[model samples]
Target: MVLWVFGYGSLIWKAGFRYEERLVGFINGYSRVFYQGSTDHRGTPDYPGRTVTLEPSHGEVCWGVAYKVSGEEDEQIALSYLEVREKQYDTKVYLDFFTDPNTTTPAVSGVMVYIGSPNKKLNPNYLGPASLEEIAEQIINAEGPSGPNRDYIFQLENALLEIGCEDKHVMDLANAVRKTLSEMKMDS
Candidate 1:
């Protein structure tokens, strides 16, 4: 069977896997937050990097992309790759994807999404609810096998802009990180 996967974070900028089709869309009833800690991709265990996790928010819609895996073999490969890449995200949910941000019609249904829950037990790497500056500070100096954590924020910001999706949280954090980086350069 074909599979549809929703990308709200790094997946937007880098799918890192093969897919038959990709469509820009959004899902309702969720708000993207940088509440998940990333020890594997963006930081070490000692200093975990912050990443996006969808928090259940009524009346909120998170804009992202949906990738369709057509072949069964390709679907298996894509899911396996994602499972490893998103190892820290312990929860998975399915939601309807709407291409039109303002429309209620779903272009695709039962699109899979990986989530890092706020429950510490379920999501061991969850670092829930921090101030914008606090998160930027953590993101600033954090690096992992993937690369600098700051790059993640900037890339996501740019990707969202490219897709015509204006996310306040992402924009604010990106600005904060940029300002912090500028201040650091001035200080040195």
Candidate 2:
């Protein structure tokens, strides 16, 4: 049997999936944004702040990468993905062919990754009502096992916008974070 997986946000740039093709794909009924903070990449796992998830129900397009997995290494690939995706996101099995009708990519099937379950422990809204800039700053300024979450957010945003997603909520949140961070600079 063959397995496929889809990546929208960090997965787009990150994922580290092994498969046949890295075709451009899209996932509907969900859009990408810098809403969730990553602990492994952005924060600490003990705090476990790093993660990606859909916010409410927004109808929009999101650019992503799809991979086709097969062979003896398939389970290994999935295990690695599960490790990176962590337990916060749901790991549901999905077909690997069929572009999102709303987004319009080539015909293909793959697994759609999402936050595993709605556990209040998963989301604490710790950063408060900060804007995109503030969030971006935290990501950049804050040290993580990797680098900064800000870079990840910016890259993902760029990827989405480059594909013409233009999610209003994503834009607004990013803008707010930027504004707050900029003001803090003046104050300091």
Candidate 3:
């Protein structure tokens, strides 16, 4: 059985695991939101970076890439890699599809997704929901061992566009960040 992993955020640009194949796909009944906070990869505990989380929204689809792992061993390796990378999320096996626009093959199913719940007590970085301006402010001021929070947003925006996916929320946040940075430069 092929193991499929769905990536809607950083994994689109920075999937550290090896995969046999990848396809553009979307998971239905869920919407992507920057409601999850990042205290490790993107920011420190004192100032966390906003990251995407899959929230249930009927009739909505979250577009992303699905990576296919070949065998049992690779599946284990991929799972292990994702465990460290996506430690903040709660894993779930979803019946989703990975579609290739140019292929005659039908969409693939049984894709696994990582989701973070706002009410989950284990996730200290879970910031739940916030206004766009509030998120942008935190992102603009956050810098962690990985890099600046702005860089993460910029890269994810670029990656989404490149993959033929448009996320208005992410793009809007990116724009806000840019505007805030410009204002800060002028003030300084």
Candidate 4:
């Protein structure tokens, strides 16, 4: 059996796992938003960095990459890695990805997607929704073991653009963060 993983955020650029193949795909009925907070990878508990989450939105589609993990052993290994990397999210199987945006074909079925829940009881770092300015402020001033939160947003935006995908939400947040950083540099 083969395992398929759907990546819409950092996983799109930094998979950190082995995959037999990758395909650019679009998942409908969901929208990506910077609503999840990261305390381990991008920020500390006191100053969590903002991250993307799949929010339910009818008629909305999120473009991302789908990784195919072959063999049972590799699937297990991939799952283990994702469990740690996506500890803040709940894994769900989604079959709405179309490898070709123009067609209704699925590159891989039963694709596992990491979804963030905004329940404080479930995830202490969950920071629901915030304005772009607010998110930029937090991202610019946040850093963790992985690196600066600003880097994450920049990388994701670049990756999406590289794949010929244009996400206004991501671009807007990225632009805001850049503007904030530029102003800070000028002030210093």
Instruction: Report the number of the highest-TM-score candidate.
Output: 1
lDDT per residue for candidate 1 within 1-188, as digits (tens), equals 88999999999989988998999989999999999999999999999999999999999999999999988899889999999999999999999999986677899999999999988988889999989999999999899999999999999999999999999999999999999999999999
C-alpha displacement of 83 in model 4, angstroms?
0.3
Each candidate structure's TM-score, on Cα atoms with residue i matched to residue i, is 0.98, 0.70, 0.92, 0.96
Instruction: Please give the ranking of all candidate structures by lDDT, highest first, separated by commas.
Output: 1, 4, 3, 2
| Per-residue lDDT of candidate 3, residues 33-104 (tens digit) | 988888888888888888888889997778899888998898899989889889878646676674754554
Q: Where does model 1 exceed 4 Å of error?
A: none
Question: In model 3, where do residues sit more than 4 Å from their true spots?
Answer: 98-106
Runs of candidate 2 with Cα error greater than 4 angstroms are 33-37, 45-51, 55-61, 90-106, 121-142
Give lDDT: candidate 2, residue 20: 70
- Alpha-carbon error at 96 in model 2, in Å? 7.0
Per residue, candidate 4 scores C-alpha lDDT tens digits across 76-186 of: 899999999999885365665687767777767678899887677876667888888999999999999999999999999999999999899999999999999899999
Candidate 1 lDDT (Cα, 0 to 1): 0.94
* Candidate 4, position 153, lDDT: 96
Local distance difference test scores for all models: 0.94, 0.58, 0.85, 0.89
Candidate 2: residue 147 Cα off by (Å): 2.0
Candidate 3 vs candidate 4, lDDT winner? 4
